[model samples]
Target: MTTLYSLYFSLVHAFVGLWLTQIINRRPRLLGTWIAVFCTNVGLILSTAVYEQTGSKSAGVAAVAMVWVYNGAFFLSCSSIFFTAYANPVAMRSIGWKLYRFYTAILVVTGILIYFVIVETRGYTLQKIGELFDGKRVHLWVKSPVDDKESDGPDDGEIRA
Candidate 1:
């Protein structure tokens, strides 16, 4: 059933992405939160808009498929790197062992990169994410300008119950 396939892929994407996030990032929980927010906006909201705009279910399906395919390819590519490294091993070992070494290396490198290079934008507005690429280098642990203090709620001028 379509519903079943959708559910399956959603779960796969969420869990796999979460697992990979834990492996690759310094703050797994924070990154996981961002991933959830990202998926909801891009996966559900954007796809719905596409379906409405084109009046075709296929367009929406394609959008969802694109997200899944991209993630799947990323995961596979990481594994393939290790696979190739062990293709003609100088030291023989099980394929599982090769994968383990690859993942450990990835974890270590990711941790160093996150600590030194990646900025912490937890609780920040996604709108200012563009500033990350505005030719200004943002280092890890720098304070974000788009903090949650800028409320998205109703203006103070509005009456509250």
Candidate 2:
């Protein structure tokens, strides 16, 4: 059963790569390439490692959970770095590879620390979990509903006389 689940995830991961490649071909960008490479390569490496290290059914379940967590973190990290690098091409050009390596190291270290430090949030509310991260910042850019009013018609909830 675990093997079947693993096989399914592996196939999905492969398809995601193919889809990303097609998208990248249409709109090439350094950040996209970096995300594709890291997500595919590191995901394969770490998931395989987890599978190899775990043999029992409980261990296999834990391995599957680890794979899911790792993938989620991998996607988010890639996204954050992509936006940062995309916004600063000059800095990306000068220190992109260095930043990539540094971020990768930081991710690994942080994951290890989190594995040790994080408490299970199974029963916690979203707000409670968010508070663990210090809550939201007011200064962060968020598109207002007013901005969407321009595109949305009167019947679509736009206030109109």
Candidate 3:
């Protein structure tokens, strides 16, 4: 539950992304490299927004299918990596294996359960799916104006500016 906090998500995901990118980059598999970078950079942003939203993404059948594949795969893959690090004596000796394994299991299990149980996007954040749909990219980081549907703006009785 504490992991729901904004800073925790940002820090963990950022660090994970960096770690994965570094490790995966050395691997022969380009998919891992791409997925790591994609999940980290774009995934981070989407998770941030979804995590902050009040009205969550609708759990339409399409969205559900997307979550099943993408979210399921991601969390499973991440858990595999996490359990490895936890089970590694060298990594654990340096980073306290017992505590790390406890946290790792908690996180991975929580993520898996949330993905399956939560139908709505409430606390269920597979930011990648949202990013896949809202796939617009602007170079710079400036705010953009929302579109006005009315031709003459709020001047008409329609009252939409």
The lDDT of each candidate is: 0.47, 0.47, 0.40
Error at 63, model 2, angstroms: 26
Largest TM-score belongs to which candidate?
Answer: 2
**Model 1 per-residue lDDT tens digits across residues 1-161:** 97577556556656675566546643554344334334433444455456657767786786567545534433421322345335635432445224334534555565465456667554444433435545443222333377835433334222234
Local accuracy of candidate 3 as per-residue lDDT tens digits, 44-96: 33443343353345423333343233433344234224554346566546653
Off by over 4 Å in 3: 1-26, 30-37, 59-79, 82-161
Off by over 4 Å in 2: 1-73, 76-88, 124-161
lDDT of 3 at 2: 42
> Across residues 99-137, which tens digit of lDDT does each residue of candidate 2 receive?
445546655565555545545454445445556567552
Q: Where is the poorest 10-residue window by lDDT in model 3?
A: 152-161
Clashes of 2: 0
Clash pairs (backbone) in predicted model 2? none
